[model samples]
Target: MQKILGLFLFGIVLLTNIEAKDYEIKMLDMDKKGHTMVFDPPFLQIQPGDTITFIPTHKSHFAQSKVIPDGAEHFLSPLDQKTTFQLNQEGVYLYVCPPHQMMNMVGIIQVGKAVNMQEIRSALPKLERKAMTNKGRFLEYAKQIQE
Candidate 1:
């Protein structure tokens, strides 16, 4: 009976430790309604161990990391394919679609905290004109996270 109780407690512990959740962001094309080639929910906040899946609902879209936290890994998804990235660090991550970068197809992810705000801010000026337009949105989201 004691052994069974121990096993049950272990199972409960394992379940409690698994806190990761999956989030989906869809890539959409420019349209008459002024969609402007963007990622739905361009900014997201998640915890370490959570995963984000970038889905290309429209053609010719992909996700590539443009800025990442120090000591964090960068990733690029294949064009027109769905890709998943796991956030393991407590900082900010910025990504963009290569072909539509000039059109400002961008996104920001905050994992646990905005620890890499300075790094992300410094990298914004390196982006092209259209891509820089998304900077305002990113900053707004970052501010929310900090608050």
Candidate 2:
């Protein structure tokens, strides 16, 4: 009976240790081209167990998950609405706008540790593909040009 009780207590501690951080992602004014896309801070730095809230003032904008080089579905926002998602692991999350991918309406969420832009740049192909698929042909061409 004592052993069972000890195991139960250990489980409780493990559960308590898992916590998530919350982030508020806001979309502000558009650029010169009148793109209704935006992301607060543009880039976010956070640790593991963090959450990001995407609040878009404009109803037409959307967020969606991008495709990582490893064939993973990175966090993506919905189009024309507000959304939120929690970061459960430590890694680089690349997100972009479904409508303004060409304008580079992109954002990054770094969790667990620090990630340099160079690392993210190296994996541009995958990111570009993911962006182009959601945004449009213009963004696809734009991503290729950057590389």
- Backbone collision tally, model 2: 13
- lDDT for each residue of candidate 1 in 26-98, tens digit (9 for 90 to 100): 9999644576788887888889888999988899999999888888899899999999988898898888888
How large an RMSD does model 1 have? 3.0
Best by lDDT: 1
- Where does model 1 exceed 4 Å of error? 1-9, 16-18, 30-33, 128-143
RMSD, one per candidate, in order: 3.0, 7.4
How do the residues 1-147 of candidate 2 rate in per-residue lDDT, one tens digit apiece?
A: 999999999998787566555788776556444544556556676666667888886566666656332323466666656777867665666676667666456666666553333556665565555543224422333332222
- Per-residue error (Å), model 1, residue 58: 0.5
Candidate 1 clashing pairs, residues 3+ apart or interchain = none
Candidate models: Cα lDDT each: 0.80, 0.60
**Collision count of model 1:** 0
